[model samples]
Target: MLDYSLDISAVERDLALPDLVAEGEELDALVSAEADWTQPTPAQGWTIAHQIAHLAAADANALIAIRTPEAFDTVLKQREAAGPHSADLEADAGAAKPRSVLLEQWREGRTELAAALRDIPLDRPFPWFGSDVTATLTVALRLMETWAHGQDIYDTLGVPHPPTTRLRHVASLGVAGIPLSFYAAQLPIPTVPFRVELTGPEGQTWVWGPEDAEQQVQGPALDFCLRVTQRRPLSDTALQATGADARKWLEIARVFL
Candidate 1:
């Protein structure tokens, strides 16, 4: 059986604000330097500018959820309602603003988000979805979202994002959520015992499940992370999944709601 109670502290420890800031800055630079007539990104007809705007909006929402306590639901609803308008604005030829302005807004949103996260007590309980969650989990969720969405921007620009230890946060969370994905994929629950060996950022390996398991999956941590997050196609990765069920599970990996 998959363990839902896997340790998440590793995810917390991997949340390096400096790394995130640097990645965000690189993405901003990429967006700003791109030519106006560049091909549309995989996100429909949206251009690079729209992607940065969406990231800014997402970061802003995360900050509100972390800091306001009582207003998260309302704030999220407002953001959802504004999504269509944002898309419509991007579709209009004259509606898209300068990349510089979008970059500034993105930086501002990230700044607010970082400050909010820094201020929250790690042990404090916060509202997430319909349930209370720890501040650390909230941070992990934000990191996951940022990294995952950042992949879209990076892929659209054909840029390589060097793997960081922070990615392990998403990987750990992603792996833990695998059983959920299995169920969603309408696959049979594996009855055999297995092990997952995930290498951490610093060449440290995190072993889960029994030591003498009948099956195992192992590979470079970054590829596994990318696969689980669905940021990269599973066929494009080097992760090796032994045993029938474990391989099938990796093929349908997903993390978001």
Candidate 2:
């Protein structure tokens, strides 16, 4: 059988930037007050400021990956040497700055990164923590990070995060992240393919993998997104798993390394 696949980088990029910007804006609005910045979020020991700072740092790193691969490799090495807490240390450093400075840096960095992502050749591989990724995947990860961290900010402020179509990007990334989830947990990657069928915010169905796959997961897209991002525990979500691998996947699912 002849296999045919189409590259959807352009489409993903188009949706990604706007959705990231929108998600950023929503979180930005909640942090206008000084007290809001220091408030502890759902992520243990993370404040609203830390969430934004992490994003700012990630955007800066992404810019380096796109603009100067060699430099990004250096940055990655530095991060590795700095150890696992490097991310928290980076966020702490950024959060220590005045709110205005951190906010401006995040805003500027995300904007610059988005613009750079647009001009890059989609086929060109960009350096990342574990491996190189295409520009399209890079932008989608940005969107996913923005949305996931934005949830922390919203939880901090006790505000309801209104569901939007943009979450489809997060859900898509979550689905793609299944194997990574296993790898991160030091578990063997499953050979059997699994199907995912989610109910989108607007009640539309979003499906991935093969329809005939014996292992399957089904749930609201938001629940799956929250699960894969590790934002919500499996017990807290309404997701259903039809196979052993599927059930195990929900237990260890995570989009980040």
Candidate 3:
């Protein structure tokens, strides 16, 4: 098995939750201001309204999970049941209603979720995706997911996504998890040490592996995260994997099932 001991403490310490909250609010505003009611997002048949509703439902579930770890499955089921509400919200997209109402719901949901996360003790364990994870790690993953899915919504809206400095959490997590996918794909392990360098949106460089290395990958962090998450194809970016093993790892990059 690949080692899961990659140090992410620095990455976690540098995360700015306030910035994530602000960006999420900005996305909510954009969703509210959208004029097209029939436009579809990349997520199957979901519209912007459905997206917002899903985010709201997810946030609510996160709040529950943060408060009572033993209730994780029940919270997930509740969130799943809210899918019909999301559909209904999307169906009313063209209705003549005050946009502020929808925005308020989104804001409230996010605020509650943030408060729950902030109140959770970092050392506390929570059930997550069939495993027990620390409260801090769970929150970090949630933030990463929110930013990535927000990007999808932004792409559908034809708006430029602002620089995602907070996305470093996702990038680091993705990079650390790449080795597992490589092993699962039955690819040969590299004989030499290698380096991986991802340049973030705000000119921040994220480097993994070794400094003096025999193999390397260097490129944009956003693109790297997208590729590793299987949200974007490797050919869509400027990322370069120099060694055979490094290239193989990229071919099967995945963070979750």
Candidate 4:
């Protein structure tokens, strides 16, 4: 009956900073010349521009959710009125803008997000995907989102996935989502817990789950992120899972809200 939510303990002051920098600069570089905005990305039916626009949309939304709840409510209402494909509508609208304009929007949005995150109190609850969570937690969640979407953009263009210490943030989110993942899959929550040991990019080992549990997953931190986000097939990675519960979690792992 214990809550398995991962304790960040230390919120990387400006958790989204590095990933934001990397993502923006990389995308900037990708379009340095007369680039192809229409190039397809890993996200189904979305082009590279759509991918970045979605991130921009998310960044702006995060800012609203963190600093202006009323504005966030308006957004939720607009999306509700627009119906199920509202997300697509938003992204497409963003993507439809001139490439230069769209890029500026993403850049400016992230810049403001950085400032908003700096002053946001940790204890203040904000409406996230389905429930209210603290601003500190939302930072890590945003970092994970930025990183995961970066994957789709890179994989779409055959670029190598960016490796960074920031991944510990995402790996933590993934490990924390095991219960929710099970709940969404309509599967029984595992009565027996498991352990997760990921060797991060900086050679730091990240540990999660219950230490004494019989089930365990261990491998490179990047692979852990890939699996949790379903950005890549497990068969393509080197993560090793021991015990039925651990293996099943890997087969159906997902952490996004």
TM-score of each: 0.78, 0.93, 0.78, 0.89
Q: How many clashing pairs per prediction, in order?
A: 0, 0, 0, 0
Give the Cα error of residue 203 in candidate 3, in Å: 2.6
All-Cα superposition RMSD per candidate: 4.2, 3.5, 4.8, 2.7
List candidate 2 stretches off by more than 4 Å.
Answer: 1-11, 33-35
CA lDDT for candidate 1: 0.68
Worst 10 residues of 3 by lDDT: 90-99
Output the better candidate (2/3) by lDDT.
Answer: 2
Compare the candidates by TM-score and give the number of the best one: 2
Report the C-alpha displacement of residue 197, candidate 3, in angstroms.
0.5
Scored by CA lDDT, what does every candidate get? 0.68, 0.83, 0.68, 0.78
Predicted candidate 4 versus true structure: per-residue lDDT over 1-257, tens digit per residue = 11323466465556555665665566566654437889887787788788778889988888888887867878878877998788788889898998999888888898788777777776677765556766567667767877787788777677776688878888877887787678778899897777999999989888876888899999999999998988989998899999988998898888853
Error of 4 at 137 (Å): 1.5
- lDDT per residue (tens digit) for residues 116-230 in model 2: 9888986787788877777777777888898899888877778898888888888877777777888888999899888999999999998888999999999999999988988
Highest lDDT: give the candidate number.
2
Candidate 1, 75-133: lDDT as tens digits: 64654676746444533422266666666777888877777767787767666553566
